[model samples]
Each structure stands twice: as structure tokens, then as C-alpha cells.
Target: MKFGYRIIFIVSVVIFFLNCAYYYPFFSDDSLISLRYTQRFIEGKGLNWNDGHPVEGYSNLFWILCTAILGKSGLDLIWAARILGLACSVGTIAVILNCFRKLHVKKEYVFFATLLFVTTPCISVWAIGGLEQPLYGFLLTLVLTEVLYIITSKSFRRIYLLSVWLGLLALTRPDGFLFTIITAGFLLFTYRQTKTNLLTITLAVVCIPTLFLLSQLAFRYTYYGELVPNTALVKVKITFHHILHGAFYTLSSFLGTFVLSFLGLYSLFILVIRKKDLFGFYLLLNIAAWISYITLVGGDIFPAYRHYYVVLIFFIFSIILGLKLNLPNWVHNKLQAGIAILIVINVFLQYNIPQNHRAVEERWEFKGMNLGSTLKNTFPDKTLIAVTAAGCIPYASELPTVDMMGLNDYYIPRHPPANFGTGILAHELGDADYVMTRNPDIVIFDVGNTPSFYIGEQLKKNKTFTKNFIKVTASDRDADYILFFNTYGNSTGIKRTDSELTIPGYLFRNNEDNAVLFTKKKLLKKMSINNRYEIILNDIPSKNWKIKNVLGKNLEVDTEIYQKNGQLTIIMIPKKELLLESLVLEGKD
Candidate 1:
């Protein structure tokens, strides 16, 4: 009877996961970036965004490689990945349940908690999103299961297995190091009870992961010349604003995904401090650590909270752990049943609440797939492209793109943004100057399926931009209406400009009569502090010119230079009917 019940419970959870996956079947824009990497690898171009250029665009190195393996075998990319990820997602429930069974959690309670976990929108979406999160979550649960075995029983073989599992966890995601560190705490806390010795402990906790990490680091550093992935510098701005956003993200995730959004954190407290349950403590500690890390980096901006998928799973596990420790276990069982019932009700009652509505309205999910198909069919390989979105455009088009928002580009993430005050995320900021320098053949602005970027608007203000890049009026197969600009020299073999164009800073105001320059060269301003600038004004300016004087509201040849952080806005107001001529910008000896 017990065996039959276990099989039915597992089957039911699997069924629930499949239904949710099919109901909200959409691939994330971010996942396409990895798919592109996998494609490049299989095509013998290596694991890079382009054939020659090797940039570690993705942080999920192991998964990228795994997908490449599947692609290499001549299987359909999306279906194969979905099949594999679904298996891993289903495996997560079984592993977690087995741990609970071993920990002596009640069978009914285990079934209920596991059901709620598998059905949660956050878990269901990523489980079938064709990303590595499902596999990452699976590896994480396996590590947790092995740790549980170590705490409950003592064996050298189990110790070795725990080390291997933890190492695999780290390989799945770099942040898995936190889990290994916290598990060391669990090991030492119960060292005497479990009879784990010093040598074994040292090797398992520190040595195994260290060896794996070192090999990866050595290769990555030698290849990319950077220790961390290129994406890290672009993201993870640990500022006050980012921390606040992280805190807000945590609350919103809990509230949005479950019937009672705040209960997960509260239950974690009850399980750890009140019940004194060691397993609960482990889960809570890991959750706290992961949340702190995510908060420091700023919670992920993607819908469905994809970044916190692993943490959410652990969080649900922690909540279940607390439920296992409740007074008069039947009352706790009733509460669990109620929570699960609420989730089922919301899935149907509020079908569009979690993320389905926005995803449908914005076509957020299909943007990448659509753009990818268009690019692969329309553009040839080696076409130099630039786009606000780094993922879909490069992946779909197979174009060696200058990632304007800097996910794959090396220079964009390392430099300060050209203009600000409007972008959605700091890490997604684009360098207009750098993009202009790269001179891509096709520059897609807010158009296409990805979110539109204001950086394109910022670039439009540049004079060289208007001269060299012309806007295309036609729309692509995708309904993205954002502007698309083609570089001047795309068709013409000859360079349009007579002389090389180099400006000290951004050209904010560039017109026929008067031009204004916002110079970021603060050092020049500081040096010119005592020295007066030779302000030459045109003798005649157009009637549209508001100012007839170039200096201090009066027409003068000399003007004093004042430095504000070495930046100066040079506004040239010419004399009536006269245009600024023979522009000379040279430093004195």
C-alpha cells in the first residue's frame, strides 16, 4: 500500500509540472544566448559569440557545454533541451521527497509539500524553459540529499559522494560555493556525532570544489583574460539602490508565486529558531546566504524570477521543513493542504496574474524566437550587427554583433555609460561611442522582440551618427516598431567623411548653425582653469540662433574656463547669420 501511494504521488507531481509547463510554454530571451553559444560550439566556431572573438558571455559554462553536446548529436535543439530539463525538474521532486522520507517526515506531509513545490509558477516555468536551471536545481537537491545522509548516518563512501555532489553544484552555478561553505558548517556542527574525521572533512568541504574551480579558472582566465564571466561586470552593481531592489524583489516573488507570499520567510524562522530542527537550519541558512547574495547583486530583472529559481526551491524546502516540525502534526498537515489548495485555485482562477498576462501582452516570450528565425533566414553569416538586446539578435541572426548593451562585448561593460536617467537596468546600459566606433552594418534599435533601449535615442544626437547612419523605414517580420539604422559605408566602398572624426565627448547639440559639445574631458577643464579659452564666434548666425554671444552673454573673443569634474559643455552661439567655422581644438605647448 505504501509503495503504491509513493508511485502515485510522484506521478501526480510529474503530471502537474507537465501541465504547467505546457500551459505557459515560453522560452526566455536570456536562454537563447546560451543556445547560440551551444550552436557556435557545435559548428566548430568554439564557445564564443563570434568565430574569432572569444568572450565568456554566459556564466553558466557547464550547461552551455551540455547543450552543445546534445546539439552535436543532431537532435532538435529546443525539444532535446526541454526533454532533458523536464527530466531534471521531475527528478528534483523525487530527490527532495527521498530526503524527507529518510528524515522521517510524514508521508502525507511530504506528498503535500512536494506537490506545492512542483506546481509553483517559478519552478514550473524554468523547469521547461530549456535553460540549465532545472538541471542546476536537480544537482542542488542531490547535494542536499547527500548532506542529509551524512548528518543522519556516518560512512566514508557517503562523504566522498557528498564532495562530488557539492563540486557538481558549483559547476552548475558559480554561486554554489556558498552552499559548500554552509554545508561545512553543518558538517562541523555534527562532526562528533557523525564521526567524520579531519582529513576527510578537509578534502570533501574544500579540496574537491577547489580543484574543479581552479581548472576552470585557469582555462577561462587564459582564454578571456578575466577571472569572472564578462556578464558579471555588466551586472551586479552592489549599490544602495540595488540592495533595496533586491529586498523588494524577494517580497514580491513570495507574494506573487504563492497564496501566502510572506509565509515562507516566517516559516523558516519557526523551523530554525523555534523548533531547533537541524535540517531546517541547514535550509534556512542556505536561503539566507543566497538571498543576501542576490540582494547584493540586485534581484534578477526577468519575469518568473528566473535568477532565484534555486533559492526558491530551497526556500520551499525550508518552509516544508518547518511544517514537519509544527505542534500536533495533523494541524500542520491541514495548513499544508490549504496552501496547496490555494495554489491550485489561483492557477485557474487567476490564470494571468503571475506572468502569463504580461508575457502575452508584450509578446515578451516570443520576441527572441521570432527575431532569431528572421535573422537566420534573412542575414548571412559574418554580418556585423548591433542591437540593444544581446541575446536574441546575435543568436538568431548568427551575426557577429557588437552587443550594444554589453553582455558579449568586452568594452561596453568596463566603461561608463554614454547617457543615463532612462535605462531599465544599469548593466544593460550601452556605450554609444563604442558602438559608433565598431561601425556595424545593421544597427537595430528598440525594434525586434526584446525590450526597447533608450540608448538608441541617445546615439541619435551624435552628428557623425546622422551623417553615417540612415534610418530604415521598413519593418521586419517581427512587429517590433523600434527604429533601425544602417551605417553609411554599408553599401558605399568609400568612407563618406573626408577627415577622421574624433570628439572629446558626446555631441548633444549638432545642427547646421551652432554645435554644442558635452565634454567628459575633465582633465582639460582643470588645466584650463587659470587660462582663458579663445572663444571664437561666427560673425553671422541663422535667425533661429537664440544666443548671439559666445561669452558671458556678450560677444567676446576670450572667455574664462571653469571646470566641473573636468567636464565642460561648450555651447557655441554664433553672431547673426554666421555659422561656426574652422573649428580648432588643440592643446597648447
Candidate 2:
């Protein structure tokens, strides 16, 4: 038994480490949101998205503190986040491994359960994804373990200790308060079993979490003038549209991992039949409540079922107990070998699954990192920028930012649309007029240099936005950048000449109302492989204008024009370079 335990523990650690390594360089952009807060907090800027402006954009308070401490020690906050997350994940494994032993689960079952826990791609992906999930997982698992010990031993001595862990759990994530409430309810539900010290037990279980909740609430109201984080306001809308989307999101996650989902659900069903079991009952409430809460919030936008990881931890113990309770005599005897085979299959499937959110995020991070570096180099430190990706670009640039999505904005959430929950989760709140009033020097619609969010779409139609900002492309040897520049704002002596029209990558002329765009044929061909470019000419004269495609017959070119909201938009598909002289727009009176 000792040898088997050691082997499984060592092997699981190695496998988890390797799994995290496989996901290297794939940091969650959202994680950087917390780290940015950490950076500000460490620099004495007061947990703010913009300096002197206090808004609790991050939900992970404990997470921010952990990284902030390390950042204060002069460590890179990004690395600090990654290391802390991974360590907490390893701690969770250690807790669960010790838990399996305490429950006296068989050696084979231990191997199966530990392997399943460690091999699940979601677990390891989040461990290094640089968010608070792993820390939340560790705290949650520790709390559950303590509860299991007390329930099995029928002891209330360590229940007070459990309260402190529960408090920490609540601080790790806003939704963690749900767990504390459930645990408090569990204690109350089992009151008859502990009739000796009712008042003491009640105080221990209830007062600690209540205090923590009150303290947090008081701090929020005092500092940011809100009872909850700004993120909650942006994300936690209770509309039918959001609920329906959340339902689909939760269903797809379960269906994606059908085998594991089946086992977890089956385990819960078995627990339901055993009406007298206290621990199993507790597990059922936690799982059901969490699933319901996740559904209510419109699920998560990130890939890899992150919101479900805590439930995954609970599923482990429940499934192990179910196997012991319900398997037939023969099946129980052969369960070890059968599960070993399943573990092998699972290892291959989880690591090699075609789920490629990591790849997509990696590309986005690369683009954001470069754009941020360019912005940092190009503009003054005080230049205010507005961005939809309130993560990588802002963190890297370290400039004042208008969080276009309201995740960190003070005004947008308070002034949300009447039908706020009808759009994308966390992206439904924005005021184009409010953002433009800030006079942001640069406005990035998305990380990938394209208009991709509700805010960007709204700004595109704003006449003030169209008249004051121009689409500018700047290129460094390291990266090509595209963003909207506010021409009405301070240019710092950077002049736009109609004769040269130089902006690193391309050249264009904005002379009077006759505009001409020029790009090297090679560059255009490289950028537009589909042989197309969409150009919107804003603030055009209200005259019948014709855009002539004069690139010559050496190659075919097509031009289509649409006039809307005083803007003439053209879709040009050219087989070669767009010559400045060839792109003449002549207006007929």
C-alpha cells in the first residue's frame, strides 16, 4: 500500500507538472487583469485601473494580495501569478491525496481518482493560466477535506479552523461566499448531532464568514463606493437572454466531457439514495448550488470550463465513494484494472484534445504585447487610451486606460443600457459617448487590431468619433500596429503631411475632401490574401462621389461603395498595390 501510494503521488505530480509545462506561454489575458491591479496596489496606486480612480475591477482580492506581495519583492507579477497558481494547484493535489488515505479508499481507487484529478486538462491549464482558480481550488479542497474529517469523526473541535479557511475561500473569489453559506447551512442542518455546544458552534461557523463578508463589503463601499466589485456589475446581469446563454454554456461543457460528467452525476445520484449520509448530502448541495450560480451568471467566456473546476474537485471524492458503495462484487474486484486502463485512455485524450483556446489566446497575447510595447514607445506615459481588451495591452503599456467594457470603468456600469444583458457576457456595458468624452488618444477595438466588440461598433457610428479619430497604422520592426488616433487631441508636434503621409507601414493622403490611400502592392497583397480591404471614409461631403478603381488592367480590381450615416465606406479588392493616384475619389455636384 505504501509503495502504491508513493508511486501514484509521485507520478501524478510529474504528470501535472508536465501538463502545466505544455500550457506554458499561454497566460489567460483575464489573469493579467488581476495582476494589473496588483501592480497598482504594489506601487501605492490603490487597487485601481487608472491612478487615483478607485474601482474594484478584480473579483480576486486574496489573489491580488498574493501577487502584490511577490511583486513588492521585485519579482515580475506575471511570473509571481503563474508560480502562485501552480503551487496552490500542487497543494490541492497533496490535500486530496491525503484525503483519499483518510477515507481509506483502496489503492487502485486512489490511483484512478488521483490520476483523473491531475490529468484533467482543465486543472493543469488553469494552474498556469495565471488566474485565481488554482488558489480557489486549493482552498475549496482544503475546506472540503476538513469538513469530511469533522463529519466522519463527529468532532466540532476543528470546525473553528474550518471557518478561517472558509473566510479565505470567500476572499479568493466573490462566488466563494456561496460555499461558506452552504457550509454554515450544513452545520445548522446537522445541529441535533452536535447539541452539546450549539452557541459556540453557531458562532464559529457563522460569525467568521459574516465578519469577512461585512469587512469586505465595508471596504468596497468605503474605497470604491460599491458593495460588489465592478466586474460583478458588468457580468452578473439576471436576464432571460443571459440565463439561456449560461444554460447552453454549462450544457456544452458537460457534454464535452461526457464520461467524467456521467460519473460525477451518477455519483451524486447514488449519494441521493443514501438519505442518512451527512457528507454526501453536503457534497450534493455544494455541487447543485454552484452549478445553479454559474448558470445564473451567464456562464463563463473563457474556454476550458474554468467555472466548473471547483465542482470537478467535489466530483472526485463523490465518485470514489460511489464506486465503493455501488459497484458489484465482481466489478469492485476488477475496478482497479479497469480504471487503470481508463486512466491511460484519459491521459492521451485530455492532453491531445483539439480544444485550441490556448493557441488562439497565445496569438492574441503576442499581438497585445507588441501593440503595448509600441504604444509605450510612441506615446507619453500620461496618454490616455481606451481598450476593449482590459488585460494584456493595458498591463503592458501601463498607461491610463478607459476600460471600454466597464470591467474597470467607474461610469459605464452605473450608466448601462436598459437592455444590458442582451449581448455578450461582461461585454454588454459601455457608453461610447462617455468613453469619447475622456479624450483617449488611442482606442483599440480589440487585441487583434479589429473592431470586434459592442463598444467599438457603437463608436463606429458616432459622428463625433468618426470626425475626430482616424484609422492609423504604425509598424515597428518587431510588430505591426493598428489603432484609431484622436486627431483632435494633443499630437505632441507629430504632424500629418499630405505630401508624405508617412506612418511606418503605409502612406495615405487626406487633402480637403478628396482622400487617397496608398500601400505598397507587396504589403497590400501580404495583408489582404483574400484580395480585399474595407475602407471607411468618414465625414465625406454630402455629394455624389465616385471611387474609381484605377489600379490598371495588369490585374483585376473591384470597388463597391456604400453611404451610411454621412460616411462613405468602400470595399476594394485589388490584385496588386493600391497606388495613391489610382484611388482618386471625385465628387459630382
Candidate 3:
């Protein structure tokens, strides 16, 4: 419980060990998108994804910019990013300890909660996953610390500093703006309590954030030519389904992993039931802002639950703050034991979960390494390359690329597919026609993938696409060797599974069946005018298969030994023989 360097070192060591525990360490693929931007900046490419266009493809700008600056020194970027993530996460623990001491919480209680936080594997998850979560966590916890100071002691300087932190938080993640606004509003409204004037208090609270926001807007308009980051548009559907996913994302990521999440939620409810104070009310406002923001964005796509990381960190600190002021002695004794048991169970789960496998779920980040190399070797000319997921491939390859779903594109995100709703992820589907019109030499559908991105689906069917690009994997003759991760076999040859057939642009697969799927209703209109659309078959049908409409209505099908110029015809050969390979739709467009 003592605030000593030894305790700090112990907590720090525990953090590092637990972070490296679940499995052999691996960074996230999404993190690489920002790294790609950093590398571009390092290369003097003027911070653009493409040569001339400066699009804000990434959400974590300050992190990318920070690393980009470090990248200029030819630093070991992998180590740098990971190390920074660790530092920020560790810093959150230290700040928590300090805040508890400042609020006069029992030293033992502070140490206990802080220990639980340090050992929580989810804390370590982001520590090594290589993203802005740790930094965001640190900034937010620090805000809570200042929020405590502002509410308890009425420090003038802390109020302004809180504004600066709030601004920096927003700049770090796009959704952070919600926190900034809510905090600023709380401070202004509570001016009477602070014993400061509205004018003085407003300046104290809003000055730093206002300037930071203005500077951000000016730079965005001048460089990226957009007021909002491109990712803001890319990851948005904002439907009721999104709210449902948001709830699932938080529960599954936080409560599913960190046992303390239940404690944190319960603590909030208890606080609401008990007497309300300035600090408690402020915490509630911030929590509401953040939760709504997360719901609006449709939750995180990355594993290990990133979106709520900082919120949980802040929430835990606030819980400690409230408990210090109010819990009974008997309740305190029980919580102590409860936390100890939770810590053990939490560690056990961290060690046993599917996350430890490092293959099926955690393999994406490791794949980025070889995938990037393969992309580079495949596209030796450094021409235009399009990818659904842009981070890992573009970052590792260090090549000129297009973010097809529009995170980095100027056009595609603005014009998404007709009916784009994945309901889980929140990115816009790229315009298939536009990507084709741009004519990327090698288009990839890995990054930011979704059903709507089936503009990617339609792209493969487009005559121009099939004519220009070929389905080339990283292990293809067109690419270099790809060493799979530990569990995967040593050989680079990966056989295509049945699931591979469903992938949009896979090679040596059924082009027609997987290409442009037309249901019975659309099929009628899809037929060319005044002629039967006769698709060449590779073989005959073995079973009865009829075209179905989008609404699942079966259509009346009629066929014959249809033949075009010189193609072989087998419609009349026999029944119970071959698999269906083609279709003959007789109708007018």
C-alpha cells in the first residue's frame, strides 16, 4: 500500500509478464494501417496514402503521427510501438495509485485494485496488440484524476489541463470528441460549485480544447480536404442493429474477459442509488457519453475488446474513488476477498481462452508480416494496389495502395453499395464500379471485409476486372514464400478449403457460382435484351438447382441444349451426371 518505487516496479513487472502470457506476443493488423501512414511520413511522402491524395485512413492520428516522428530516425518501429503501448498502459496503473492516494482512499484498497488492473490480461492485450488503446487509457485515467481534483479541491490549473487532455483524447480517437464535449459541459455547468465565474471557468475549461479542435480542423481541411477523418465515414451504419452489437461488444469483451467489468457496472448502479456528488455526476455524464458513442459506432471489430478499454480503466478508478468515500467496513472486507478470487479466475481464463491458441483468432496480426512482404514482391512495379483491409498489407509492403472501403479513398466511401448492412462492423462498402474505374492492377478484398463490400463481389464479374487482374495469393508463383505462424505447418502451400470458395476473388474456383449471384427476380431483369443469356458450362448438372429470388421465392426454370458460336453443349447429354456449372436465363433486360 505504500507509494514506493518497489511497488511501482512490482506492478510494472506484473503488467509486462501478464501481457506476454496468453500466447506468444502478436500485434494487431488494424494497428498497421496507422503504421503505414507513419512509414509514408517517414519516407517523405507527405502523409498521404496515395502519392498526391492525403486521406485520413486511420482513426488513431496522434499515435500514428508520434510513431511517424520516431520512424524518421530509422528506429525499430515494431519495438517502438509495442514499447509505447506498454508504457501507456503501465502509466495508467501509476496514475490510478496516485489518484487513490489523492482522494484519501485506504492504501490497501488502492493497492488491491491497482494489482487487479495490472494483472488483468486484457490490460496486456492492448499493451502488445500495438494500438492507441493504452495511450487513450492513460489520457482518460489522467482526466479522471483531474476530474477528481476539479471536483474535490477546485484547482484552476487542473481544469485547463483537463481540457488539454480532453482535446488530445479526441485527437487520438475520433469518438473521443464526445468525452471532451461532455466534460467541458459538466465543468461549465458546475461553475457555481467551483466558486469560479462562468467566464473565467469557461476559458479555463474550453481554451485548450477549442484551440486543439480548430487546429485539427484547419489541418484536416488543408491536407486531407475533409473536415472529418475518412474513417468516420467508413465505419458507420448507426442503426438499431448497431446498438445491439454495441451491447454485445461491451459485455463480451469486458465482462467476458475482465471479471472486474461486473464489479465496475455494479459500482455504477450503487453510486446512482446512493447520494450523488459532483464527481459522481461528472463520472456518470462521461460514462453516458462514451457508451452512447460506442453504440453509435457499432462496436469494435478487433478482438481483445479495444473500444471500451479506456472507459473501463476510467471506470475502475472512479469506482475506487467512490468506494473510498462510502463502502461499509464489512463490504470492504468481502470486496477484498472477492477481488483476490477474481484475480485468480481472471488469470486462469486469460491463460485458457482461445486467445492462447494464437492461430485461428490471433493469427491475423502475424499474417500481416508475410502478407506485406508477399504484396510487395507480387507488385514489384509499385503500381496501384487495392485492398479491403489496408493496414497490414500496405504497412508491411510499403506500397502505393487504395483502401477500397473508403477509409483512405476520396470517392468509394461516399458512394457505398445499394444495400450495405453487415450489422456487426460499421464500415461503408466501397463502390465496385468506382474501384474498377480506377483500375487497380491487383485488387485485394481482405481489409475491412463485409457483405456489402460485395461491390468486391461485382468487381470480379466485371469484364474489365477479370481481363486485368488475376487471383494471386501471397504463396502463388507470382509471390514470395510465406512462413505461417507457429501452429501452421512449415510449408507455404495452403490448400483451399470449401470456405475458400466463398471468398470473393479466389483463384482456380467457380467464377460463375461465386461471382455475381442473381436471385430469380433479379435474374429476369439481368438477362440481356431480346436474347437468352447463355452461360458456357464446364459440366452438366448432377442435381436439380433452381434460381431463387432475394426473398427466397423459387422461380420457374426452363433450359435446352443452348449453344453460342463454337462452345460445347451438354444440356441434353444426360441427367444424374455432372455438377451445375453454368446458367441459361431466357429473358430481356
- Candidate 2 lands at a TM-score of 0.83
Runs off by more than 4 Å, candidate 1: 1-5, 154-156, 192-196, 260-263, 327-356, 359-368, 418-423, 449-454, 475-483, 491-589
Candidate 1 lDDT tens digits, 1-589: 1433477466657666665545456666677778888898889877788766588888777777777777889986666667777778778877777777777876655665565566566676776676788888888888877776765576556777778777777776777777888887667765645454756777887788777777788988898887988777777666777788888887666666654334466677787778776777788778778878887777777667676677667766766666667747547536655755766764663355655344324444366556555655544465577776666666666767787777887887777554322235444467677787877766675334222465566577766566555342223432533323342435211112222212221111232211211122110111111222222122221122122222122232332322243332234333322212122232221
The full ranking of all candidates by TM-score, starting with the best, is: 2, 1, 3
Q: How close to the true structure is residue 187 of candidate 1, measured as C-alpha lDDT?
A: 70
lDDT of 3 by residue, 437-486 (tens): 76565565663122234556676566655543433222322332211111
lDDT of 2 by residue, 7-76 (tens): 7778889989987777777788789888888988888888787886689999999999998988899999
Q: Cα lDDT for residue 500, model 3? A: 20
Which lDDT value does model 3 have at 123?
A: 70
Better of 2 and 3 by lDDT: 2
Every model: Cα RMSD to truth: 12.6, 7.6, 12.5
Steric collisions counted per model = 9, 1, 5
Error of 2 at 114 (Å): 1.2
